[model samples]
Each structure stands twice: as C-alpha cells, then as structure tokens.
Target: MNFLYEKITFIFDPLHHFWEHEKLSRKISIMLVLFFVLSLLAIEAKRLGILTGPLFSFVPTNHFYAISAAFTVVLILEVISLVFTLPCSFSRSVGKQFEILSLILLRNAFKELSKFPEPLTFHGNQEAVLRILSDGFGALLVFGLLGCYYLVQTKAAEKAMRPTDLYAFVAAKKGIALTLLGIFIYMGLHSLTATLAGREHTDFLHQFYTVLILTDILLVLISQCFQPSFYAVFRNSGFALSTLIIRIALAAPPYYNVLLGLAAAIFAILLTLTSSRLFGKK
Candidate 1:
C-alpha cells in the first residue's frame, strides 16, 4: 500500500505543483483548448471524407453529435476542477458535481437532436421528443437546484478548523485527487483502445461514476477527521447518495433516467436545506 501510495503521489504531484504556478497553469489551459479545437476539426474532416484513417469511421458525423461530444470533454474538465476543490470545501465540491451532472444532461439533450429525423416533426419521432424533453427539463431543474445549494451553503455556519487540521486535510485530498487522475487516465485509454480494436467500449459516464462513488466514499471517510456533527455527516452522505442515483440513472431508459436524476437532485437539495436550517439556528 505504501508503494502504491507513493506511485500515485509521484504521478499526480505535478498537477498540484503546476496548478500553483499561474503562468504554467494558463499555458496548460491554452494547450488543452487548442487540442480540443484540433480534435473537432479532425473529426469534422474525417466525416467530410477529407481525411482517411481507421478512426474516421468512429467519428460522429452529425454536427449536433460532434458539438455534444465536445461538451462532454468540457464536463470532464469541470469534474477535475471539482476534485481539486474537495479539500477546501466539501459543500462547494458537491455543488460543482451537481453542476457537472446538469451539464451532462444538457449535452445529452443536444445529442437527442441528432437522433431526430431530417424533417424534425413531432409525429414520427415521439420517442426522441420525449428524450429531448426529459433531458432538457432535467438539466434546467438541476441548474435551479444548484443555485439553491449555493445559496444554502453561503448562509450556513462555518466550521471552526485548526490550521494544522486544514493542512492535513488538503494533503490527503491532493493524494486522492492524484489517484483519481490515474484512474481517469487508465479508463480513458482503455476505452479508446477497445473502441479502436473493435471490442465493446465501456460506457464512459458509467465507468466515471463508478470511480466517483468510490472517491466520494473516501472523502466521507476523510471528513471523519474533522469531528463534524451528525447533520454534517448526513449531508455529506446525502451527496454520495445523490451521485449513486445519477449513476443508476445512466442505465435506465430515456425518460425514466432523467426523472430519476432530477429526483435525486431534488432530494439532496431538500436534505441540505433542512439540515442547514436546523443546525444553523442552534
């Protein structure tokens, strides 16, 4: 375990180190943006038959699908940012996760547009219409819930944390973030290689949430060191439960999946708001 921990630290330490340096961080961000743009152009060219390669066939031809795919990449970056924020404020991190999930739903809604028939009438594509409606509604609802969470969080009382404890918490969270980064790299490469090799590629969101669930569990365990009250524990656990619900939604049928995801967000927000009111009043 010690060896594994050291290896993870070695791999992820550079990310934390670079993030501390403003110039280096900005350069990395610009590089990522350039890469994303180049990827989109390459995929577009492949679709247009201007480029010939084994990967061309896998590239999404529809403009809507291509745009949605790009947004999914952005969502992944947002989740990475959330992971980095976990050590500082758990509530804020949870809020960021909610935002990412909502964006994922929005991306799905965009993807649904690609499924619509060319004429795009309501009669022939009822199923697609339902999917679009469900996804769009779910995205809007989650965004509203996120706004409420932010408000509740701002009004909530701050926990008194010792400087030493804060340092320890940040260090532990950084290690976990590095481990998560490693897992993400492995999963992404595995999925891409499998797809290119003609094997079944794993569902990206499903695999990601599975890893996220484990990370959330680790975070909850880490939170135990701060001697939080019962409500705080409950709230954190609720966030984990919310993530699980979203993961389960990924496997459900179209409309049902959106409904389930929205319900989870609603439940989480209500729980947090109630807890804040009760605990903050004391």
Candidate 2:
C-alpha cells in the first residue's frame, strides 16, 4: 500500500503543481485570446469563401461561434481544475463542482449567441434571448450560492478521523484522481477525433460528467474503508447524489437545466449544513 501511495504521489504532485502554476495560467490566457481572434478571422474567411478544404470544414462560419469556441476551451480548463480537486474533502470537491456548473451555465449562454444573425437583429431572437437570460441568471445564482456553501463548511468531520485512516483515505483519493486525469485526456482526444471525423456534435462534457458520477460513487464507497461512521458515509453519498443531479442538468433543456443546477447547489448546501450540525457537535 505504501509503495502504491508513493507511486501515485510521485505522479500527481508535480503535475498538480505545474497545472496550478501562475505561469501556465498566463500562457493559457494568452493562447485563449489568440485562439479567439484566429477563430474569428478564420470563420470570416470561411464565410467569404477565401478559406477552403477539409481543415476548415468543421469550423462554423459565424463570428459568434468564436465566442462559443472560446467558452468551450475555458470549460475544458475548468474541468481539468475540477479533476485536481478530487483529493480534497468531499464538501470541498463538491464546491468545486458547483464552480464548474456555473461556468457551464455561462458557456451555455455564450453558445446561444451563435443563433443570432450577423447584424444582430431582434426579430425571431426572443426564444434565444430568453434562453440566454435563463442561463446567465442561473450561473449568477449558482455562483452566489457557492459562497454560502464554502462559508458553512467546517473541518470538524474530517478531523474526527484517526491520522492513519485519514492518510490512507487521502492516498486512495489521490490514486483515483490520478486515474481520472488519464480518463479525462482519453475522452478529450476521442471527442476531438470524432468531431474532426465530421460528427456534427459530440457531447463530450456530458459524457465526462457521467464518468464523474461513477467516480463519485466510488469515492463514497472508498470513504467507507477509513471512516465507516454513519455520518461520514451519508455525507459522502449525499455529495455523490448532488453530482448525479449536476450530470442530469447537463442533459436537460434550457429552463429545466437552470432549475436542475440550482436544485443541485441547494441540495449540496442543505446536505452540508445538516451533516455539520449533526456530527460537528461531537
């Protein structure tokens, strides 16, 4: 077990540090700007028939799609960040998920922009505008609620575990997180390939959330090994259920999606408060 823990740590620690580095974030920000500008120019070129051939085939010819593309890249970065949060306390990890959920909502709002005409006429844009409103406000609501979730969090439950058991639980989660990173890469590459092969839409994020649900369930079960107490198990399981709701929200239609996301966030907040109240006193 020690050997396995060391191996996982050796792989995860450096990668996490590099991923969290300020330099990398700056580089990615610059790249996102370049990507957005290049995408707009390329899209305009495609629209004007100046760019030809299969390389540009998958690229949409709308300038608004550039915004969507930028948001997609941002969402990908957020999901990568989410994967690194897996080794933390369940509540903290779930909080991170809520963060991503808000971003996803914002992304959906940007995606709705693609439906607008180039000159941005209001005619026939009512439904699209309403969808945008739903997504934008939904994102804001989730973002605000996330602050509450963090504010109510206490370390008492986590501190209740024995040191050795806590160590084992953390190591186990680290291994799982490392494995999740691998799966994330594979899914991303697969999605890209499928898109390049002319698949109109690949629901890559949705597929990944499905995998996350399974991972959350595994995490809940793994917590049983080190902290078999009722409160601990129930709390972890409730977090997992919250993740499942988030997954469902990804598939739901616009208004329904917003409602589900809010529901998930509220459920998580209530769960945290209940667990903290029940077990934190001891």
Candidate 3:
C-alpha cells in the first residue's frame, strides 16, 4: 500500500504542477479564444457552402452556438480543476463542486441561446428565453450561496491522533484524486470517440457526476480510516449527499434543474452551518 501510494504521488505531482502552470493556463485561454472564433468562422463557412462534411453536420450554424461551445470548453476546464481539488480538505472539495455547478448552470443558459435565430429576435423564443432566465438566475443564486457557505467554513483542519496519521490521510486522498483523474481522461476520450463516430454520446459531465457520487462515498470511507470522529464523519457524509443532489440536478429538466440546484446549495449551506455550530470546539 505504501509503495502504491508513493507511485501515485510521484505521478500526480508533476501532472498537477503542469495543470497549474501559468504558461499552460495562458495557452489554454488563447486556445479557447481561437476555438470560439474558429467555430464561428466554421459555422459561417458551412452556411455559405464553403465547408462540407459529415463532421460539420453536428455543428449548428448559429452565432450563439459559438458562445455555447466556448462556455462548454470553459466548463470542461472547471471540471478538471474540480478533479484536482479532491486532494484538498473535504469542505474545500465540496466548495469546488458548488463552483462547477454554477458554471454548469451558466453553460446551460448559454446553450439555450443556441436555439435562437442568428439575428436573435425575442418574438418566437419565449420558452428559450424563459429557460435562459431560469438557468442564469439559478447560477447566480448558487454563486451567492456558495459565498455564504465559504463564509461559514472554519479553516482549521480536522485533528488526527498523530502527525503520521494526518500524512497518511492526505496520501490516501492523493491516490483517490489520481485515480479520478485517470477515469476522467478515459471518459473524455470515450465520449470524444463516440461523437466522432456519429454515435449517440452521453452528456459527459452528467456521466462524470455519477462517477463522482461514488467517489465521494469512497472519500468518506477513506476519511473514516484516519478521522473517525462523529462530527467528521457526519460532515463528510453530508457533503457526499450534497454531491448526490447535484448529480440529480444535472439530470433534471431545465426549470426543475435550476430548482434542484438551488435546493442542493441551500442544503449544503445548512449542513455546514449546523455542523460548525454543533461540532465546533469550545
């Protein structure tokens, strides 16, 4: 177990460093801008009969689709960031999940925009407009609630019986985080292959959220091995439940998706507040 843990750490550290590098982030930002502009140009070209292929079939010829594509890429980056957060404290990881949830809601709002005509008239797009409002405001509400959640968060780490125990706990979480990163890359490649093959690809983020639900449970169990206090268990388990609710929110329809997301956020905030007040050391 110790050897495996060391190997996982050895591999994860450099990958994590590369991901967090300033140069890579700048390049990714530049690539995203280029992708957005190229998407718009591609769509216009297809519309004007300048581009033709089966690959272009799925690409909608709408200015708003470019925006949606850009948002989707941004959301993908956020999810990757969330994966890295798993090695942190459970509370911090949960906070990262909430951040991704808000971005997903915002992406949904922009996705609805793709349904509108190029000129973007409001006349026939009432339902789409309503969806946009629902998802947009839902994101804002979660964003605001996330602030409150963080405000109530205590910065102190949970105590272990020994320093070595704390070190082992972190090592275990790093292993789990590395495993999740592998699964993430596999799922991403699988989804991309399906899309390219003209197969019906699943919603990549939604599928990953299902995996994340199981991962949260695993995290709770692993955490118990090091910190078995009632308060610690309850807090971590409650956060797992919050993640489950977020998974459901992702699967829900538009208006109700927003509602469920808000419910999940409120539940998390309440859980944090209650746990802190009741469990804090005097």
Which sections of candidate 2 miss by over 4 Å?
154-157
**Per-residue lDDT of 245 in model 3:** 90
What are the per-residue Cα lDDT tens digits for candidate 2 across 1-282?
888887887888899999999999999999999999999998989999998998779888779999988989988999899899898888888988899899999999999989998888888999999999999999999999999888888533454778877777888898999889899999999889988888766578888999999999999999888878787888899999999999999999989999999999999989888777777765
Point out the worst 10-residue segment of candidate 1 by lDDT.
1-10
> What does the lDDT come to for candidate 3?
0.86
Each prediction's TM-score versus the true structure: 0.81, 0.97, 0.95
lDDT of 1 by residue, 1-282 (tens): 456555655665677666657897678678667866776787678767898776566665555666676677777777667666665666777777788778888888888877765456688778787787888888898888788778777777766679766656666777888767778777877888887777776677668878888888888878876747776677678878887787787778787877887887787777777777777665
By the lDDT metric, which is better: model 1 or model 3? 3
lDDT of 1: 0.74
The parts of candidate 3 lying over 4 Å away from their true place are 155-157
Residue pairs with colliding backbones in model 3 are none
lDDT, candidate 2, equals: 0.89
- The positional error of residue 240 in candidate 3, measured at the CA in angstroms, is 0.3
Compare the candidates by lDDT and give the number of the best one.
2
Q: Which rank order by lDDT, best down to worst?
A: 2, 3, 1
lDDT, model 1, position 124: 78
lDDT against the true structure, each candidate: 0.74, 0.89, 0.86
